[model samples]
Target: MRILVVEDDAGIALGLRTNLQQRGYAVDVCASLASAWAALSSEPFDLVLLDLGLADGDGGDLLLRLRQARAAAPGALPDPLTPVLIMTARDQVADRISGLNLGADDYLVKPFDLDELEARMRALLRRAAGRAHPLLVHGELVVDPAARTVLRAGEAVELAPREFALLLLLLESRGRVLSRQQLEARLYNWQDAVGSNAVEVHVHHLRRKLGEGLIQTLRGVGYFIPREDGA
Candidate 1:
């Protein structure tokens, strides 16, 4: 999972980035709301760790803007419904209520335990995806999205970043075909030069890593994972 950390305190931001990275999450840190806005406008993220007090402005404003953008159009914001967790020094009951009312998925005060923060993040992510657990099981294949790890028949499978992402997308959208264009858009950012064969290459790599019949191609349409029931 990818996360954006909006914090002005250098120590806190660095610690957050290091800890989250160690836990298998791709992280980006910014010291101000402006940089956070720019990052949000540019790339997609699975979640945001927002600090209320920033170098330039309050984080609540940014959260409001993000919620507003999500309400405007289908794709107005990257991951329009992306989960947000507020991490700040403010601990008052009203402050917590306000942040929650402003669309913050969860809130954590400073001096919080790293383990608790991680647990909260996982909970919010699972809730956003409408999943009851962090593990996604499809027959003999087990995927832990939070850990960014996959196991096939009790054996761990190592995959490149792109391959893992492709596998995750396919697993998440099982029973539905996803076109090359849609896959490229989700996997690559705007700056990436997506070659015509980019998706095919990744798909090939994934199939080799997993199995031949894992992901089925529908000729000119797209690719999909066969339903677990084999319907």
Candidate 2:
């Protein structure tokens, strides 16, 4: 998934960007509130990791603006229900309450373990996908997004990080076709040097590992995984 990290702490931002990328997520970091707002207005992010304290403006203010924009005109923003998780040094009861009331989906105090942070992120992503359980079933394939494991016919299947991400995205949009541009935007961050056929290469890798017919192409349109009825 693509995530926007709004933080000013250079060390913390670098650590988060590195860790999230290693875990198979496309992440973009913004140091100030202005940059964050600009980023949000430009692209679609599956989730946002926001810091409360900002040098230019308060993160709460940005959160309020986002929610208000969604409420007033949902189409103006990339997603009306874009999830936000606040990570801040504020640990007071009121601060937490205020953040939650301002549209933060989840809150985590600073000085947190990366493991726990990843777990929470998984939970939030699952919730956003409307999945009560972590496992995703497609025919004989069972995918554990949290564990980053895949089982086909009860046998383990190992996939590269990019391949796994592409599979997950295809599964999530089972009946819909995703253009190569959409896939590229969701799979790669700004820093990654992408080849012209990067998405095609990833899709080719997935087809080889999973199955030939698992992912279908539209010739001139895009790619999609067919529904059980083959629609």
| Candidate with best TM-score | 2
Pairs in steric clash, model 2: none
Candidate 1 residue spans exceeding 4 A from truth:
70-73, 78-80, 146-149, 159-166, 176-202, 217-226, 229-231
Tell me the lDDT of candidate 1.
0.84
Against the reference, the lDDT scores of all candidates come to 0.84, 0.89
What is the clash tally of candidate 1? 0
TM per candidate: 0.79, 0.95
lDDT of 1 by residue, 1-231 (tens): 667889999998889988876665667888998989888887667789999998799999999998877435654554458799999999999999999999999999988999899999989877876779779999889998767788999999998877887787788778889899777766764334779999999999888988999999999999999889885
Error of 1 at 208 (Å): 2.2
User: Which candidate has the highest lDDT of all?
Assistant: 2
TM-score of 2: 0.95
